[model samples]
Target: MSKGKTDDVTGTDTTGHSWDGIEELNTPLPRWWLWTLYLCIIWGILYTIAYPAWPMVSGATKGVLGWSTRANVAAEITAHEGKNADLVAQLLATDMDVLPASADLNRYAVARGGAVFRANCSQCHGSGAAGAKGYPNLLDDDWLWGGDMAEIEYTVRHGIRNEQDDDARYSQMPAFGEMLEKDEITAVVEHVVSLSNADFDAQLAETGAVVYADNCAACHGEAGLGDRSQGAPNLADAIWLYGGDREALTETVKNARFGVMPAWGPRLTEADVRAVSAYVHSLGGGE
Candidate 1:
């Protein structure tokens, strides 16, 4: 039985633990700290009994209190819905066309619409609705369909070329590669490029104009201006849904450009559709 060593400098007993010239002190913890620590252990045990704490194979223990964070969250959501029930009801009842007439309602619709857009529409249209290479930019006036509130609402509800919606705005461009020769497709691409007034081969464009008129002019118009009725895109404008460059135009002509938009009418509530329409209309490009 050996006695514990002591440090001469501080006159404190060593805890019999030492390494690299350093010795641990055998100092006693404060009574208050020790008591508090015991209290904490007791409290933890009590808490485990009072609330869901113990884990099991199937689930956690449902303690005596049966308290649940999930239940609290559900209650909070119900409360929020209750608070806005009247406003939401009114929005639902209001006609889509008349929505813009009321300033307060319109503002509310746009605000709520923005949230819905971010959650639902942002994946394709982009967070800011700037669109992508295949997607049409909502921030620009170049719309395959019209951009007015009513028009936008209709488009949003029915969608563009959605197989699910029978009434979806449907149009298709014939794959020129299947019909025209490779050289003819290239010439058509050059002519289409020239419509945007971009630099192109003059000789090729001259030859392509005849091919375009025979195959494309019926929908695209003689001047290459798009027909809104048929959902045709205006080729004369600088804005292009897909790119305006020679390569992009060439690919489009050869393979055909078909974009599908899912109809929101069946999925979203009527109020949500109206709200999103209003929100999209507020973005600078909306007609």
Candidate 2:
């Protein structure tokens, strides 16, 4: 490499380096572009100093400006709660049984409850509360537990078959596969199917009736109408938590279904439970 020199053709200073006889130009950046770059660097430093940045072990560093997105969100939530304080108070004070007496309060509860249902209950019971396989439908009159507002509230508060709450509605259907023989299970399944289906095997159902009376008459009534006292679903109805088909009934009789609903009493506020109960009741299935 030689010292810096001017090129004869272009009359510009070379960078004093050449590759294969080609010289590099010592061109400078535009003054405006250089200033803009400097300004950007300064702005970035200032922004970091004025806003939350720099991750730490537990959390991010608090900026000098004291601005926090989490705090802003929490403040907005507090403001909304303050606005609804009166309605919430009225809701908690009013008994669930007499909730319908106050149209305004009932409406408020249903609306609020709809939001709560979508957040929590929708995962299992579905958005429309129609329910799915293994989950009980809310839009229909059939309920494992009672469907009245009070019953619905109690179920929501304590839940069904959950171990979290001591007051949870606990019912354990014995897996008859371990107790009854394969032939007896098949007969009982046929009998259960006959309770809802008119086109059932008479001979098989007759045999199943004896087996059912000996085993299932306590929870599911002798008529197979189901008793709500123990959260037993009505076998006579077309609606079934698992299914009404022969195969589904056979599996149910053999293995049994033990669905668990979590106790919302510990997670949700009293008002929330009441509101969701009201919302479920208003879905056109309330008794």
Per lDDT, the best of the predicted structures is: 2
Cα shift from native, residue 82, model 1 (Å):
3.3
Model 2: per-residue lDDT, tens digit, 80-133? 989999999999999899998899999999999999999999999899999999
User: Which parts of model 1 have CA positions greater than 4 angstroms off?
Assistant: 18-23, 28-31, 34-70
Q: Candidate 1 residues 215-251, lDDT tens each?
A: 8999989998899889989999878878888888888
lDDT for model 2, on a 0 to 1 scale?
A: 0.92
Go through the candidates in order and give each one's C-alpha lDDT.
Answer: 0.89, 0.92
Report the poorest 10 consecutive residues by lDDT, candidate 1: 1-10
**Model 2: runs farther than 4 Å from truth?**
1-30
Q: What is the overall TM-score of model 2 with all chains considered together?
A: 0.88
Compare the candidates by TM-score and give the number of the best one.
2
